[model samples]
Target: MSTQTASSIEIEAFEPHPGWARQGRQPRIAIIGAGMSGIAAVVKLRRAGYTDLTVFEKADRVGGTWRENHYPGLSCDVPSYWYSFTFAKNPDWSHRFAYGPEIQAYMERTARDFGVLDVTHFDTPVTELRYEAPTWRLTTGRGDEHVFDVVISATGVLHHPAFPDIPGLDSFEGEAFHSARWNDDLDLAGKRVGIIGTGSTAAQIVGEIGPEVGRMSVFQRTPQWMAPLPQKAYSKAWKRFLRLFPFVQTLLYHFYYWYMTSRVGGAVLGDEKAHARLAEACRRNLAENVHDPELRARLTPDYKAACKRIVVASDFYPAICADNAELVTDAIERIEPGGVRTKDGRLHELDVLVLATGFDPTRFILPTKVTGENGVDLEKRWDDAPRAHRSMSVPGFPNLWMIEGPTGPVGNLSLITISEYQLGYVIQCLDKMKRDGLEAIAAREEAFDAYNAYLREGLKKTIWVTGGCHSWYIDKTGMPNLYPYAPQQFRKEMQRPDFSEYRLIHEV
Candidate 1:
């Protein structure tokens, strides 16, 4: 039995079953996590008449990233109306941007309402997932094995913590933890705190805890685009109006999609006038919040706006300018028994060190071994540079689909929106398999390569590529790992499943 290349394999068409006229066989489906992607899959699957589905979540709780990262003042950067699922809406969001707890509760409630809670296998993580010819066999962390006809890789990026490899980091005398794994039992009241990495996470953490700490020393590598967040509690009258007029809420949701993609994304791509205009707005916002020239300069980003993720914080600038706060721009040399030592030959002493260091955004799947045809490992196949056709399927891997594949979340649009679009596309592919009695489906390598090449070509003019900042959106080669297109473009791309570029493998 010799193995075959994806292009060389031949898939024969089978005649329909006599009973097929009555009903089609529902494929056994397994979703990896219960996060937003997984939950979206479960909800949509059930709606599409897919009952044989199970969601395996490693954690005991339902909220994926939100449940993990509970640092000070954690919240969704996007508005709550736009950030929610298509099937559910929270009209009573206390603020425009929902906090971590509220987002987690929303996820929990969505799971409950969608009946995904009962189908979810809690505390069960897939230790190994491999494709066996026509089906996928998954092994749980508990050492149990199960087979499924289709597997959706929905365990998205941003879960794994990327800790800096500073010298003597392990020997830190004080309590140190990543913002993703925030320390709750240990109080930082009146304690000198040192926060590292001034990215999106760092901005929120600093704003939330700066007023309470005795002293805050923020170590920065590069400045990010900081914009003012008009975060405020909803007025009672407004909330009541939103609840009464549900269409108004729906309209608001669509408006955000347009605003973030067309308005914000257009500014970054070939719109020089708009780019300068938005940049001026951010600079003015920074000036109004931070009075000190030095502090304001330090807060200002040299990169173009929307290069890295723009930090939306109302208090982060003011927090850094506070008398008890000190922003350290020098490179970190090492960690000592007392605190961090910088290249400036100064030891920034601290009682607690908060690593606001963001996750390895490129690494979408961690700790999961995915093997495809001929025992080709997915990680080895990617070779540090991951690629997928339309951020969904790969060539060698059949009957497997990635929810938010490489460069999947490049656009500033809501990730939930992206997940559903991909879900809908994959479901159509699976339905074709069920209707046609096909055993395997793999994307053509030529198609995959073509899509990525087009993405790279388009990225050359975008802020993430041309802008001076090095963000997680790009790979080591400086080529973007994201799609580098507007949300509307992506939606248009996934609006239909093009089978011309795929190898539909029918069972012999």
Candidate 2:
């Protein structure tokens, strides 16, 4: 092993404007969720010389998605090197696409190494948040209460699992569970399996267990456009070299970010040439992989490639084409006691049923009753739709910052990179608070409305709206709950806070 460690890597500190020391005292910070974003927040805050912080995690461990999801073949689509923290780069990822366990290990190691695990209160969920002028009150699940000057909600979007609404689903005699809540004790060898939905999770599970299972019935409500995922193992020699010279790994990280995000960003934002190239790649991948015309037609999607979150898999096609696996396109009328009943009067029998129907993406900072200044309820305010100014601040919530909140960039880019950018932006806002000696800060109502209005218009050009497919990205308001701007533009916008759009408060 190299003598140099992640701590040896020099990280630049945020240089607050001159006269930043005019603030009276550092604020007590409470961070909800010990996920990747929450871990990033703690690291950045401490690096910026703010040590008064505590992290509340509902689980017994860190690594949110990676911790919760552990089904077969669960892996990140983003490259391993690029899907890591800039401060702590891993030189020994097993593959280009890191598996869920590997990613979870990375997260735990990062938290342990950076001292995040020490300050984090695992198994303590924040149930309520109430703004009391300059300070905020946080109530935990254990009936414990804490006061803080600032609260950061890093509660991720995809934490809650969403099961299918098929009738008689609960009546299934077989062992059934959502993909997120996988039953590790159950063995799958020679057992018949039935998977519902054709999203990424279902694709991954089918690809891994198709040959081993006696039979597999994949219930596809809609076919997904699969992009070719080329995974390569990192050689031991390369790993050693990366360990010796970490800067090379950093360079590779930036290169991957630029390469991956540029293609995805352009394609989703209605760039004609980029969209065409991406669509052709997906179509060609399907055509070349599945040769049978009947099977190919069943697997082909009616919508555009980037319309829904593109499923990335190298083994899914071949696994589905295997004799043991059958892709059922018939509409599922209801789940029966022993199997699934389709509208065609066919019953697909199974020993195990897995619902990979995905999560409720809109439940950010929910189940936590949050009351802002002057008796403003966050749930009621966003009854129509979830909206945040610049994806971080709400109009009524003062001294509250959200990382990867509503309207955040949700493209094919690595979420690690996006969360880092948002953390940097949040740090800048906090620094500004100190410089101004402000008691609290919130986004202006007009600014929040205008920013969402701009997002509504910008989404019109994106593939999510015009690509002729319904996706989870669209909110109840018939608008996309994502940032529609280019990746470069997002980075630029997050570099600093636009103070004019905020409502800064100070008491006499």
Q: What are the models' TM-scores?
A: 0.94, 0.95
Candidate 1 structure quality by residue, lDDT tens digits, 244-319: 9999999999988877776666776767776787788788888788888887787778888888877888878889
* Model 1 C-alpha RMSD to native: 6.7
Model 1: per-residue Cα lDDT at residue 427:
81
lDDT of 2 by residue, 37-153 (tens): 999989999999788888888888888888999999999999898999999999999999999999999999999899887678877889999987777888888786777878999
lDDT of each: 0.82, 0.86
Q: After superposition, how far is residue 388 of candidate 2 from its true place, in Å?
A: 0.4
Residue-level error in angstroms, candidate 2, position 355: 0.2
**lDDT (C-alpha) at residue 296 in model 2:** 99
In model 1, pairs of residues that clash are 407-481, 407-482
Which regions in candidate 2 have their CA more than 4 angstroms from the true location? 1-23
For model 2, what is the alpha-carbon lDDT of residue 191? 94
